[model samples]
Target: MGTTLLGIDTKEHCFEAQFHPKRPLLACACITGEVELHHFDRENRTHELAQSITSHSKSCRAAKFLTDSILASTGADKFAALSDLETGKQVWRCKLKAAGYSLLALDTERFAIGDDDGGLRIFEGRAPKAAVSWSENTDFISDLAMGVDGTSLCAVSGDGTLAVYDVRKSGEKGLIAMSDFQDDELLSVAILRRGTKVICGTQTGVLPIFSWGDFGDQKDRINGHSMSVDAMVKLAEDSIITGSSDGKLRVVAVHSKSLHSQILGILGEMSAEYPIERLSLSPDASTLACSSHGRPSVQLWSTEAARRLMEGESWESIFEVPDEGAEGEGAKADPTAAESDDDSSEEEQPKKKRRKEKKKGKKNVPGSNAKQHQAAKFFAGL
Candidate 1:
């Protein structure tokens, strides 16, 4: 029961959505600057004239899908354009000084852009012009991902950091991995390949899970989203499929932090009148496409019945749980028996300091530091 999807309301500021890697069509963005492109079929209905179109004049933020036909859009006024998904026409616009949010096609002849200050240009061939190459935050730069061999790139900043550049090295060359939650502002990032693991999402409602080589304490930590997770999807090398902003959606399994399935929404259009942002999965993960919150009404899901109800525990042994003093081998000497119980607590500390001076509070005149500084200067110059 796959082919099904709907959502078309171009009200404006719809940020992103794209799928045409083989066309059943889907493309989005609206904040008035339009760029709609729905097309569903096989009973999955949608076709307001094969889906409308327009381009930045105001709010678009980002929209992608660069191969299998071509499409791109960005806004907030730094404009950006490329079209021709079977005759939409535009071909190129480029204004950029700082106004993209995030977009990475990285194929169909190079494509990458992440702005709103943290620049990161890269545009290639015909009418294309952009080349900041790399830059680093002062504010927005929501998300970027390209490293399946496009060399490298994985961004996420709006003040939370998560870089990792090295796209043929020049400036932002590194193993960059900064993750500070200070006020929590990451939003999203996913890189499950090379080395192994890197998933993030914040804005308070957490979903960490780092460890892609350097390792350090975070191989799992998902605290029931109260708001903000926006989207995530891997579905294989250990499964993953999140979405939050409270309209809830989950499938996590990261070698078992468990929660193998969940989906709730119904009435007033699934989940009390919208609130999800984005989510996509279907390169054979079955099919899932969602979007909610305002002009957010896109739906389609059924990854073969949630991957057969996520199979019940085996997410590597139901989220493994064995590392508190790692029991056995004398529990690694229990911190030296907790430092010999701090040497039997310094041999019971002077019998608890003379029973705490017999429970009193004001008594310190056992003589001379210049007679207690002359009795506190004779009672402060009374």
Candidate 2:
């Protein structure tokens, strides 16, 4: 099982949670229009509220770490603001034409926000106004991702399109390409496979893969989840951690050559009770922070633990189901047995209980030898 390092009860739903670029701090944008920073001590396995700032008049929809000392946030109040993390004060605030739904940090000196009216705006460091704003998407922009070079920006929208822009240019000249409308709304996006592929998470649980420059249509699709993939973060060039509407977080491996993908492992033994809303990986890539829709708490998990399981011999067992047939056979054998034997001594009864418990424990272990051997064969073929 993956280790849960900490859980913070915000008492209000957190729309997003982001980790500091250099410090062991987490920033959360909440439904109450508040932005909170929490300081965590990994050695002691504890966390405390460091600061809280009222950022918006309405729900803060997204937040991103612009630098080690600055956090950028946008909200339903139609405003975007930058706050100084050390002083816990607003650096500058700007009112947009519409409510901002997604935010992305291009670099320490520049950032971007996508608003509810399909507006995409880029703002230079501490600027009170957008350097440039445009409306290419016909619906709300659900997510935004920055390319590896920091010059290319991508946005996924509720209108079922993926739009790309060149941060170096402005207005229509910056519009690189806009994809054809897909069957489902795009919720999240990531640039993967060394910037050769753009992966867009859809409302229907499919990942539409677009070739870097070819946004006309999806080159491939990976139907990996049973519910909507609400959020995703690239862990490696070929792997990503996806949070789904089914409340499960899974590590998936993407094969560029074969245009195939598979679930490498799941983050936890059991799914959360609510849909996952956001996923943020720490700068060092050692920790992951997650928040769920309608949930009042944020969970921090050990990323190393997940990586260890993925690379371990029992990786395939992460999603294994219990052997119901074996369990049923055991149940049948005990159906007519008495709860306690009247003729037996108390000492004998205790010993019998111990043996039964040991036997039950042995039966619950995942992946038998045969199953493991088969898994090896299956992966070899891949």
Candidate 3:
């Protein structure tokens, strides 16, 4: 079973939650235009409210730690502000041309924000204005990702296009490449495979893969989820954890060859029971934090536990829903099994029926277990 270390009830809908890059602190952006900071003790499995900063007048769409001591946030109010964590004071604020929808910190001194009008601006330090700004996307930018070296900036947009920029340049010179329009809206993005691949999650369940320096078309696609992949975070060079509208968190391995990329297998999974909206990995990569749409809580899971579990057994065997008869035996064996009734009740019947229908409708695909074996071998290497 996936080990849930902690859960926090914010009493309001949370749009995003992010962990500090170098601290045990978690910041949450709320629909009320507020930012809450919490300090967590992972070993003790406890979390306490640290500080609450009223950073925006309207819904705060995103919040990120520019430094261990500085919290930056952007909101639907069309403003971005930086807050000092020690004093809980707003040190810097700037108004934008449109409502800020996404934010990314390139480094301690540089940060970027994407707006509702397809505008993107990069600010240096706490400058009164953006040092560089551009509008290459035709719609709102949904997410932003930075290359490993921090010079290349990539943004995915609702217009179904991906835009890459050279942050070191300004004006038209900064625009590195723009992708052709995709069929589905791009919601989230991540740079993986040592900066050779750019993966974008779409409105559909598919993940479109773009090769570095080549953005005209996707090199490959991975259809691993049944619903929209709303959020994702790279866990390793070849692995990423994706949160989907299907209400499941899955660790997927992306294997790339000469010109194609495919999913090796799902290494681990945990059910959240709601559409996941945001995901964040701890700086140490030992914990994962996530928030779901319309849910007033944030959940933290132990990544170490997940890794150990995958090393021992296949992900499919670990998370597979048992037959109804087996559930009764499981409940009898573990008294606390009743606690999961709420999550499993709605899915149990339909899932079983679907499994039966799949078995009867078509011949089982060959080499299905080969993926599982490959996943086991991959985990061993990790």
TM-score top scorer: 2
Cα displacement (Å) at residue 53, model 1: 3.4
lDDT of 3 at 164: 79
Task: Supply the global lDDT for candidate 1.
Answer: 0.55
Give per-residue CA lDDT, model 3, range 29-106, as digits (tens). 887778988888888878888888999888787999988889888987889899998898889999999988889988
Positional deviation of residue 46's Cα in model 3 after best superposition, in angstroms: 2.1
Name the better of 2 and 3 by TM-score: 2
Q: Please give the distance, in angstroms, between residue 304's alpha carbon in candidate 2 and its true position after superposition.
A: 2.7
Q: How would you encode candidate 2's per-residue C-alpha lDDT over 113-186 as one tens digit per residue?
A: 99876789999977668887777666677889987766778888776777787787777677766665675778
Report the error of model 2 at residue 18, Å: 0.6
CA RMSD, predictions in order: 23.3, 16.7, 11.5
TM-score of each: 0.31, 0.80, 0.79
